[model samples]
Target: MSAPRFALGATVRIAERTPPVHHRVPSYAKGQVGRIVRVCHEHGLPEAYIRGDGRPFQRLYRVRLDQKALWRDYAGAAGDTLDIEIFEPWLEPAE
Candidate 1:
């Protein structure tokens, strides 16, 4: 096992690239900024899984994003949030 690329409470940005095939990152999360709320267990990358690579494992994180930030016309309360589980490779340190 290797050290996790991201620490708890760290802010990160979801990569916006569109894959040619199956992917786990949702369309709403692309390019969105969020904070790491929890560090879940490591798992294989879905990208690799779709490609039949069974040995690749990456850290999974539960990120919390404000609902208002994801939707321009969101009518929910200011405190509403969305939690998403994302793989390490799909995330980068928020600038």
Candidate 2:
């Protein structure tokens, strides 16, 4: 197996580009910054899977982001957060 691209607690930013075909990344997560909460299991890329390809398995991560950061007018408490499972390819290291 290959080494994990991100460790727990590492900060990451979701990629903002759109896929040419089907994808699993949620639209609301694009360009958002979050911290890796868990190193989830690896799986085949959804885009590739839909095309019937099975040679790829990308690391998945559970990232946590403040709800307020995702929405400008979030009405929830300051501590409200959203956790999302993201594939490694959709994430980039945040400075």
Candidate 3:
């Protein structure tokens, strides 16, 4: 069976602790507002070398966050936005 596909634009709840961590994705981003941007069809090597949970990866989502939301005392153009891709396991239906 194919891995299930999560809904885009669907709110998800992040695990208190889960999946592993990588440089691309930050730990502070956990339990934050992120929107699904795209879905990766192919499976590649696991990004988390520390966890060694490299199986097959699916459910890629593009999460957007405000610059001020991620940082404090921000001195950048107002309304700046940042985007990141996260796996399904990293998120669930947000309460």
State which candidate has the highest lDDT. 2
Score every model by TM-score: 0.94, 0.94, 0.62
Error of 3 at 15 (Å): 3.6
Ten-residue stretch with the least lDDT total in model 2: 47-56
- Worst lDDT 10-window in candidate 3: 42-51
Q: What digit string (tens of lDDT, one per residue) describes model 3 on residues 1-95?
A: 26645665665554455444443456677767655555555343356545566566445666666677667787898789777777666667664
- Which portions of model 3 show Cα errors greater than 4 Å? 1-4, 13-24, 42-53
Query: For each candidate, what is the lDDT?
Result: 0.91, 0.91, 0.61
Against the true structure, candidate 3 has what lDDT?
0.61
Residue range with the least summed lDDT across 10 consecutive positions in model 1: 47-56
Once all C-alphas are superposed, what RMSD does model 2 give against the true structure?
A: 1.0
Error of 1 at 60 (Å): 0.4
Output the TM-score of candidate 2.
Answer: 0.94
